[model samples]
Target chain A: MSIPLTLVLGGARSGKSRYAEGLVTAGPAPWVYVATAQAFDDEMVARIARHRADRADGWQTVEAPLDLAGALDAAPAGATVLVDCLTLWLTNLMLGEHGITAAIEALEAALDRRAAPVVLVANEVGLGIVPDNALARAFRDEAGRLNQRLAARAGRVLFLAAGLPLTLK
Target chain B: MSIPLTLVLGGARSGKSRYAEGLVTAGPAPWVYVATAQAFDDEMVARIARHRADRADGWQTVEAPLDLAGALDAAPAGATVLVDCLTLWLTNLMLGEHGITAAIEALEAALDRRAAPVVLVANEVGLGIVPDNALARAFRDEAGRLNQRLAARAGRVLFLAAGLPLTLK
Candidate 1:
């Protein structure tokens, strides 16, 4: 049987990562955390540190600043995996000038190959006013499209706001 | 009995206005469409015109770019009213250097007195990464606070994505 995939979409500080962690922790211990955030600045460094301190001891984190598919592939079979975020992963790809389409396909293939439950966390970035900068606009558009695609492929989809979860599918 | 109030929150082009219109139109003819959009650019002018053309003939449009509370108070009793958005109204308020707190109080008072069914549309703007500018950051925080306040008072609340509604409350 195919493993269940869940897509958790939320805004910044909307408790998406925490919620996804809870989902992973519900079934078993020793979960794999595929973190995609790159600490380019102090703010991100602080955030990454905070997230690390938030969870319990059973999480084995795999850093995948650009190689998310490969990191997920390295996770053992039947071990629940929580991908802290896809937004930062996408940002990494864009900044690194990697092909987004190909990266997404590889990620999809990796997900298909998984034999354990996987929960993907993503930011819902397109719900706000259009940005003045071209890059911000393009990023929001890409984030929205990515979210819709992942949500469609997932068995369950949830939208979170203000630390509350609302099931979308 | 207090008339039902619904808050429909979504990103740009997420079909929020259409959903709110549906809620108003389900009741009776001659519904009030309280438009808060001001066409400062050609794109906005075209978008406003398109939205007007998209709706049916039963809508009585009211231009309330700043005086939203006053315009809302003018609607007849028992006539369902659809406020196309609060985001643009907030933008107008901020750009005009108006007092946001006082205006929000007036709006809340206006909502409290309404005996007609009301559907409010607002863009969810805090989901993206931290914006580069202070103004955008402030605007998003204000928007988020506004949504939360109005949502608490609303009889029904929905968060929309890709034209799909996820009931939040």
Candidate 2:
């Protein structure tokens, strides 16, 4: 059977990530987690550690700070794979000075080739006032574009608010 | 007939304000625009000006920098009242050493007393990585709480993404 893809979108503390994790864990065992976050600071390190502690044993974690497409290709077939977030992956790519256009194309291709069910988490960052800085504005615009693209490709999309899930697709 | 209260939420540049304006304009001839923004910078001045220019005549604008409840109470009955935002008013209250708890209480009370059809706009800012600063984190938390309260009280809540409105209530 073809694996269905789902996208979970929410603001910070909206429980989107938890919801996505629940979806993957509900379907199969020995899940593969594609972690895109990089611990660049103390807070992030603690956050990452907390997430690690939250998951039960039986899950294999891949540190895909970049090369997300490759990480997807590496996952075992018929296994449930969860990409913790796409925004952090985008941030990593931007900070690393990678070709964002080519990276997005590759990531889309990877999603198209996946044999296992996949759940992706992304932040909904475009719903606020325009940031004062040009960099922040650009990032917000880029994130919106990326989300639109991903939402279009996914079989289902869910938006989280106040820790509640509202299916969008 | 009781006037409808609409809560319009979206990310930056998501056309949320425009959408809210459309809602008010669609209902009545004369409109009460309850603007919560304080133009503290040139960019903001330009933004406010742009919004002003975008509207046709017959809009009576109320500059509610801190006294939002009073402004709302003063709006004409049987007219459309659009509160451009709540987050900025919260920021103003926080910065001006005003009591947030009391302000929220007053705002809620005012919403309860409105005699006109009201459409409120607010930014959804709780999504994304946690802010590094304590002040920012506090602000995000407060925004989230305030949004939940207002959303629960609102007759209808709409989340805007990619310029599309998805009704949540």
Candidate 3:
């Protein structure tokens, strides 16, 4: 079967991650977890620690704050690679010297070249009042664009809310 | 000329709102800013105040934390409607009894039925490390999926980073 590309999305407090984890558990092969977060503060540090404790010991955790393309490349073929989230990855790229276009292009290329199933998680942030600040508004705009590109490439799309999964594509 | 549907995306401080305002400033009226956030706390109250103070007198603001389809129906046919962000809207839906699927379907129908040019802003949250907590992971997953569905419907997609926009579609 052709490798399936799954994109999971939801708002805060939604149960998308657990559902995705369940999918990974049921799937085959060497499981790889691609993480994109950088603990910048105490709260984030604690958050990271909590996530680390939740995973199964068998899964190989790859800390990839940025350059997900490279991380995907290094994973062995036939492995189920789960990129925990895309929003943070985009944040790292936006904060980095390399532009957003280049980062997205690289990610798309990596997804296309991969032979294994890839499950990517991201946040839904576009359903609110327009921010008054310049910086907040810009982030929202870019994220909306990035999500569109990734969604178009994904074969399966799911939205989770209140711990429920609703398959969209 | 046909009105263009614009997608604005960003993170917490990525400047997505201000950029969208700039776009509106250059476009035709009657311009409507659809506010999808609810003030549930002191921090949110302050954030909302900050956003309100940033707008020009020419823009008319409409507060609709839920029932976005109804809100869209109230907008003028030829006017420009800017749905500030999608994250908060999803949050509102999750907090409600209708759940994710119904909310998504309603929003999709609204987008399809609307005649006005709609500019949507959202946050991209899938880049970081997998959250150790089940709740955080679930939120990340659902947000990613919602973003994908909306992005697929948007005509133009833009990714913002460090206040810069990279057009992807």
Residue ranges of candidate 1 with Cα displaced over 4 Å: B1-8, B13-122, B125-157
Model 3 docking category: incorrect
Cα RMSD of all models vs. native, in order, equals: 6.0, 6.6, 12.7
DockQ of 1: 0.25
For all predictions in the order shown, the interface RMSD in Å is 3.2, 3.7, 11.1
TM-scores for chain B, in order?
0.97, 0.95, 0.92
Identify the candidate with maximal lDDT. Answer: 1
How much lDDT does candidate 1 score? 0.87
Model 1: per-residue Cα lDDT over A57-132, one tens digit each: 8899999989889988899987899997999999999999999999999999999999889999998778655789
TM-score of each: 0.61, 0.60, 0.53
Give stretches of model 2 more than 4 Å off.
A1-8, A13-157, A162-165, B1-3
lDDT tens per residue, model 2, B41-117:
99999999999999878899999989999988888766788888888898999889899999999988887787677
TM-score, candidate 2, chain B alone:
0.95
Best model number under DockQ: 1
Report the candidate with higher DockQ, 1 versus 2. Answer: 1
Model 3 lDDT tens row, B1-169: 2336788876655567877877877878888899998999776787788888988778888998987888777888877888877878877776674588887888778777777788888877676456666656666677789888777777888765434465777
> In terms of lDDT, which candidate is stronger, 1 or 3?
1
Residue ranges of candidate 3 with Cα displaced over 4 Å: B1-169
